[model samples]
Target chain A: MTNKRNQIKGFCRNVDEKKERLKKAFGYILKDKGFGNLGVNKVSLEAGISKNLIYRYFGDFKTLIEQYSEGIDYWTSQAEKRDYSEMTEKDVLKNLLGEQFNYLILNPEMRQLVLWGLHESNYNTTSLLKKRELFAERLILQKADKRFDGRIDYRGVVSVLMAAVYHLAAYSSVQKANFCGIDLSQDKGRKRVLDAINLILDNIYDLNEDKKKATNDNE
Target chain B: MTNKRNQIKGFCRNVDEKKERLKKAFGYILKDKGFGNLGVNKVSLEAGISKNLIYRYFGDFKTLIEQYSEGIDYWTSQAEKRDYSEMTEKDVLKNLLGEQFNYLILNPEMRQLVLWGLHESNYNTTSLLKKRELFAERLILQKADKRFDGRIDYRGVVSVLMAAVYHLAAYSSVQKANFCGIDLSQDKGRKRVLDAINLILDNIYDLNEDKKKATNDNE
Candidate 1:
């Protein structure tokens, strides 16, 4: 009985190791080639696992994509978890923008995946909406202030932030237009872009204050 | 001699009328199908002009798109030209946001054309770049306040505005998700979004003020 139990334990351990290896391989494949043009056979071969194993673990190609998308959300959420208490508001804003930039720039596969989500009809309803909501919620939470009154409109802020971040990301990934018609490669241009973002934030905040004051005076 | 001169004048008038008709037809076609999937032959037929005439006037499909783009830009610029002299800062911001929203929501064809410009590889580079630069310059000039002497970062402002506007445009166009999470259709949600944007803007302006003060102290 003891010998049989040891054999089963060894088999389970081996299976867990193989699962880890497969997930690592999947990341590499996704990073190297975008999800839009990824091949199941290639992913299976790269992972050094059977095609059967892929189906067994992730069901099918669509399911695999769904799983991959979930993983992306998980990873992004993890990366975005910051200690907001220690950081200034400006620092937080800068970090948020910079991190988003880095993710879109460095991860071509993920960029392509997002584009695919935007374009492909099959992936449109389930994965894209889920991801978008998750992204907005995560972002809103990260930037939320404890002092924020329930009266303060947060949807508008999310809308603006989403617009800013997604537009920049899309441009960087696909449009390749430098912000403010300035050369992105130069330090001056970079500073100008950063300054422009700061200005936009200032304008929105000022507008909010005016609204708030009006509300207060009315009350 | 009088009869011949009268005939020539009549011919010129007819030609001018035909040109006006074709231009109007072009606008209709653009509004209906968008530049991304335009059919030149169909446009020519619908315009009641010979196919060869389209080629003769616009040179090619690419030139046709460029012409349409320029026309749309001119129209938007004209529409957005406001007498800012008497407007408060909050009013100005509201006007800008409202104008953007209205423009995007109303002008579906122009919006699609802009999206195509971002995606299509065959767009004329020089013309597109020129248009973009001109648009950016106009926005900056219209919004800039020389007397403020604050570190109003125009580039950052542009970035944020463009991001917000474009993202909203894109998302609204493709929004298929039901109202489960992040319900953008709701009034309360919309208010929250506006408030969030205002808060971000306030922070940006505050930073600008600090920077201006620092610059003055240094001098």
Candidate 2:
């Protein structure tokens, strides 16, 4: 009985050590920005573990990536948790774009993942992409119909708006450049960019109303 | 005298051949996208020339890149040559965004260059970036005050719009997937996206008018 119990304890300890190393490997992946420096050798170096151990724990690099991808919904789920029902249309736009921009800038790891997600990859990141689309639908598209009363292409407009927010954050991080004289490296400059987004959203509302009114008069 | 004349002719012929080879090397640069296949060996192979000849003509890779950079302004200059004074604000927005979207889709090489220019590089692509900004200033920023009437952040707004246009073009090229149900691969789908852009621009005009009216009422 004593010998059996000792064996069980040893197995549990090995499992725990493997889990820790796996977590460290994932951290390295996020830091490296989408498999730029990804290899079993590199992960082992970063995790302070042996190459054989990583192969033993994750089976292979593909399996390790698959495990990491399971947590991809964390950001999207966080965005979906917010309740925008009580907010005005303008406020909704502000909250959505502002939250996205802030989240991107604040979380560089997530930002890299999102930017990497935009490109075509052999990896199975389709789940991550789908989660983002579903979040956009729930948060922005459903409200867009009533907000603009179908005056705009809700999906396309939201896509452009969201894509702008993403590219702005990603571009500003790597390049010390400004977009249209608005400095992106500074918070003040990024805020102006957000304010400009709100103005564009406001424009959408106004244009929709004008279209509706003109149609009514014509009738 | 005859020998001297022959020497001059041979020298001129060799210079012209080197120039032709250099032109072919630059063409490979655009096609390769982000200098992935660019090197003395690769360029020489593409141009059907020897590596020593390239070094003799352009001195080095840096000078070869610098020579190519001089032609980067061709597109921006073409945009600046257009007369926008006679155009309405809506038409101005249309022409600008339309030209940009169409040009991006039609000219894949230019599109690749623009996307590649977004990231930091060892190559001297700064002049290309500057030319794009200057073109924006001339085409959009200079007329923004009159079009938006100081009600909107003209610079910021133009930046978002331009960024969106770029991301759309760049994103659509690589990924087979569509964002938010907008099929970027199809002409009809792209047209809907463009229409969304026009609606957003139209909103700017309407919002500015509403702001002016509200101010008048307050006064």
Candidate 3:
């Protein structure tokens, strides 16, 4: 009985190790060659795992890709891990945007998915986008922040701000270019961008402090 | 001599037709299959033009793609055709952003390049992005209006607004998803976004009219 139990323990460890290796291989291939090269054969070759093992471990390439992709996407994985219990809804929204800016710049795999959404609208790209949209909806619209509605175009502002974050981070990461000569790729540009986001948010939310007071009084 | 002239004219007509055919094939392939399938062999096959002619007419694949891309990129082609001479610098900036928002939604080819910049940073994608950056830089920074400088973070603001436009346009064109429950792909959402952009600019520019007057008084 003891010998059988020890063998099972070793087998479970091996399975976990293989799964981790497969995921790493998936991300590496995504970063290296993008979706065009993300076939099961290519991934199996890259991972040094057999097709049978990939199917057995992760079911199929699509399942594996989605499962692995969920790990990299900010709204799906990283943002899900953050603790927003103590934060206000506005602060939470700001945190979401700030984290996405840094994540898109730093994470090439996520960046590739974001870029892939342009010309190629397939499961590989849309699924991640859907995940992001759904996640943000849950956080921003569903659970909290009904106070600011009709008072400001906060939704439009957030949409525009988030869009800019994705564009600047993804474009600048690859091309040493500028929008209006503001190269936000470098560190000096970081504070400027963050400050600008804060400034814009302040304009939309806090700048109308008296208006908010008037609304409160009327209510 | 008349017969000889007629033969030369027919030969030139065939050459022009063949070039146009090749360019059309290039765009179709880009739209249908994206860069992964956009090879000279494929384009030649699709166009039914010989490889030798593609070389003789357009030089090489890179040159052909670049030349073809220039025709489609807004800043390089369409925006270049616009008469912004009558407009003030701020108005010019507004027009630039507005045109881009509409164009990105309407033009899949340009949208593809904007989206492609996220993951695939190659000649096909980067060339278009470089063209846009240079055009905006020249228009926004070089030729006019340093009045807004030091008074505000217009560069940061523009960068953020432009970034959001890209993200919203490209993502919505595909996903039909909402950002903050605002389905900006619709016409009603268009006004909300445009108004938000105008409002942000007003907050940045006109809201500080008193401040500008104060600064002028100091001067």
Candidate 4:
């Protein structure tokens, strides 16, 4: 009876150890160099855990990716919670674009992981799209309809606004040198990107009003 | 003397044959299933050309890519020449977005090559920026300044507009899924994309007018 009890305690310890190791493995994947490119065995070795444990916990690499993807919505919501209620249209856009730019620049690993996810479309693109749709519905389209006095096509307006902001982030992240056109090692380039996004937002608001007038005339 | 003349003529014939074979090899590389995943042997075998001849003409696969990249400017110019001048701002934006959307859908192979170039930074993206700068200077910035009484930051405005358009093209090319929330394969989705661009443009124009008035009041 004592031997069986000891065996049960040992099994519980093994499960606890694996759970701790898996959490560390996730952090290692996010923080360490060459971790993204490592195979499952290499990641297991680096995490000081057995490959079988990883398989048992995460099921497979793809399942691990799905697990990670499950957290994207939470992160996106957190990012979107920056207050825009009291700001001008220009201010709102500037804040939005600025936030995205800063996040991508500060989080190179996450940015790279997002790029990998973007490239691998068969993964969790639906989750990404869901997050995007939420941003559109809650932040951009809703705000535009509320602020504007005309029959504005909110979806259309938001699409351009979102596309512009996303492009700025992408350019800064992937082709920073080409997009910035100045010294990339400094914050000057980043400022230029923000300025560019603000300008676009200003133009978009003006253009939307004009279209509303023309549509009314036609009616 | 007669034998020597025959030998010279035969040498010229062989050179011509090699050149023809190299051109055919380039086409095969561009059009074949294993494009982008190319090697010297595969290209040589597919083109029915000698490996030595492929090396002689192209130096390496990288050189071939460089040669192809050099031709992009010509193609872009040709694509840009499609008439939109007679259309309203909305129609112009619509046609532009439509053309970009269709290009991605219709030309998957070319899209793949371009995406690869974007990721690899293979071509001179600076040249692309220069072309964009020239387009903005001549078309949108100068024209808007001359025609409108609005406070417009020409460079910023143009940059945002171009970036938004580019975002649509880049997303469509890389993702192969419609972010416009409509089926890109259907006509309705195509119209929605065009309409969205138009709405964004109209709003921008209105916002510019507002900015101009605000500047006037400050003055």
Candidate 5:
């Protein structure tokens, strides 16, 4: 009975340690070679674990990949970490986009992943995008529609704004030269982009509110 | 005298034909294998022209690349073709941004080039970006400042809108998937983005105009 218990304890520790190792190896390959290189053999070799063991532990390599990616992807990671318990709907939306811009700028690996995701629309990337889309639908679209009450197309607003954040971060990461006279490389240039985003969002919020009030007055 | 003149004419025709062939090859490679696959040997091979002729004709490979790229790049190509002689400054600016969105959406090669341009920012892409920056400075920034004064940062507004246009077009070209609840693939979805763009641009124009009038009244 004592021997059996000790074996069980050892097995659990082994599984936990191996999972961590696999995650580190996945990240290393993802950064170095990009998403396409995350094959079973390469990852198993990098983790220095047996292929069968990895399969046995994760059930499938893709699950491990998805699990690993979710931790690093800004949407998945930040969704859990961000405290939006107190802010207004407008504030939460603004914060989400600004934080995304900051996160993509700071994380080169994440930027690379985004590039690959845009380039290739395989099962993996499509799946990743689906998660982000679902998040947007539930959080921004559904909620913003309720608050703004259809003053404007809220989805379109977020789409353009979110896309701008993604593109600027990706472009600025490499070039940092300029986009329409705005030098994204410089601190001043980046601030201008962020400020403009804030300004636009504020304008939108005001527009929604004013339109809302006008309708109320009319009634 | 007749023989010598005919020989000179024949040589000139040969050079023009070779230039066309080289341009075709460059486009072929740029679309097929991407920018990295563009090398002298491959272009020569595809064009069925001697490597020495390519060098002798263009003076250098980079010049050929730039020359070829300029014709396809939206800013360089459209600068010559677009009829903005009669439009107001506001109309022209709005049209430029909106046209870029339509152009990028329609041109897949342009989208691919954009992806590479963002990924790599060597002399080629930077120079390309420089041309765009110069155009913006000369055309938009200069005139916009004269018109709007210190009303708003026109550059920032343009940056977000332009980047969003690029991102959505590129993302839509490949994935055709929903981004933040906006599906860029469908016509209705695309119309939403374009409509939102016009609305945002109109708001900025009105804001700038309103601020300008307010300042003028005070003076």
Candidate 6:
């Protein structure tokens, strides 16, 4: 019984190693050829793992690709595990959006994946977008001050902000063009865009202040 | 000499007819199979015009596509010709954005083409995006009240708004999912989003008013 248990543990260790190798291979493939060229054969060849093992371990190519994608979650899979101690709602949004812009600009492969996601009928990509919205809800909408509730349409604001982020990333990735004369490819341009985002966020908070002031003035 | 002139006119007429046929075929193919499946063979087959005529008339499929795409310009092609007299600034923006949303929704072919344009390195598409910016500039920036300048980031505001429009249109086309609980697929959800957009626009104008009020109070 002791010998059998040890043998099973050894097998499990080998399986984990193979899974890690497969995942690393997928990253290499994704970085090299992007999401469009990713296939089981290429991954198997890159990882030096057999096709049978890939199938057996990950069930299918789609599942394996998804498993590999978790390492590069665009939204907040890794950040979800963190605590937001003492951070204002504004700070959270600024950092979150700023980080997203940097992440997309820095990681070409991720941008490609996201661009592919926008077009392809892939379940994992769709789910990832949905997950992103959920993360925004948890971080922004749910935590926003109650005083600014109706005055600030959190959902609309977030939606427009996110759309801006995604579009900027995608546009900068492909072309050297500017959105509204702000070239996102350059730092100055990017700063201007970020400032614009901050302005919008500030406007939301300011709306709350205006309401309060109006009431006080009347009183 | 008269016979020769008649012959020349006949030849010109034939060329125009073939060009029109090729252009129509390209549209049908785009609407049917999207930009991805568009090819010389597909266009030829659809147009019922020979490959020779296609090559002769357009020089190549790329040029042919570019020409076809100009007719379906996403911004300010047909709309540019319309009169915007007797409209407030807010009315102009609201109508412009609302029309954009409807145009994107109604024209799936255009959406796919726009999505393709975002990724692929096509000169025509790139030019179209530039033209789109110019359209926004003409409609929004050029028409915006100059007194509201500096105090309100009009360029940033327009950038974010255009980004929202493109991203929302692209997202709704590829997925059935809603953004921030707003189902863009449904009219009610779309209205909610449009309202959010209006609110943002209103905030920009309101900022100008507030600044003026503060100045007056200080005086």
What is the per-residue lDDT of model 3 for residues B155-201, given as tens digits with 9 covering 90 to 100?
A: 77777777777777776676655556777668788767777787787
Q: Write the per-residue lDDT of candidate 4 for residues B1-219, one digit (tens) a residue.
A: 999999999988987776566555654665444233556677678767778876677677656544544443323544457665776543544455556556655554444343333343434444454454455344445556654553544344444555565555545544645553444435565566567666555555666677778878999
Task: Indicate the DockQ of the complex predicted as candidate 5.
Answer: 0.63
Where is model 4 more than 4 Å wrong at Cα?
A: A1-50, A69-77, A80-94, A113-120, A135-150, A176-186, A199-219, B1-51, B70-77, B80-98, B122-150, B173-185, B202-219
List TM-scores of chain B, every candidate: 0.69, 0.78, 0.89, 0.60, 0.90, 0.84
lDDT of each residue in B1-219, candidate 2, tens digit only: 999999999999988888677766776666553433456777777778888887888888767766665444335635667788888756876787777777776655565455445444335555566666666667667677775667777777767777788778756665556687677778877887788777777667666788889988999
Interface RMSD of 4: 4.4
Q: How much is the lDDT of residue A214 in candidate 2?
A: 95
The residue-level lDDT of candidate 4 at B1 comes to 97
TM-score of chain A of 4: 0.65
lDDT, ranked from best to worst: 5, 3, 6, 2, 1, 4
DockQ of prediction 4: 0.28
Q: In terms of DockQ, which candidate is strongest?
A: 3
lDDT of 6 by residue, A1-219 (tens): 999999999999999999999988888877665565677899999999999999899998878877767667766445576566678878888888877887887776677667666665578787777777677677777777465656666677778887888778767767776677667678887777778888888888888788878878999
* Greater-lDDT candidate between 2 and 5: 5
Error of 6 at A44 (Å): 4.2
What DockQ was computed for model 1? 0.28
Task: Give the range where candidate 6 chain A is weakest over 10 consecutive residues by summed lDDT.
Answer: A76-85
Distance from true position, residue A99, model 6, in Å? 1.2
Best by lDDT: 5
Candidate 1, residues A33-149: lDDT per residue as tens digits? 444346778877888889887777666766666656555642344444556557755455556666665566555555545544433336523465666566545544435433234
**How accurate locally is residue A203 in candidate 2, as Cα lDDT from 0 to 100?**
62
**A34-123 in candidate 3: lDDT tens per residue?**
766678988899999998999999887778888888988888888888878898777887888788888888988888777666555677
lDDT of each: 0.57, 0.68, 0.77, 0.55, 0.81, 0.76
Give Cα distance to truth, residue B152, candidate 2, Å: 1.6
Q: Score the docking of each candidate (DockQ).
A: 0.28, 0.50, 0.65, 0.28, 0.63, 0.51
- TM-score preference between candidates 1 and 5, better one: 5
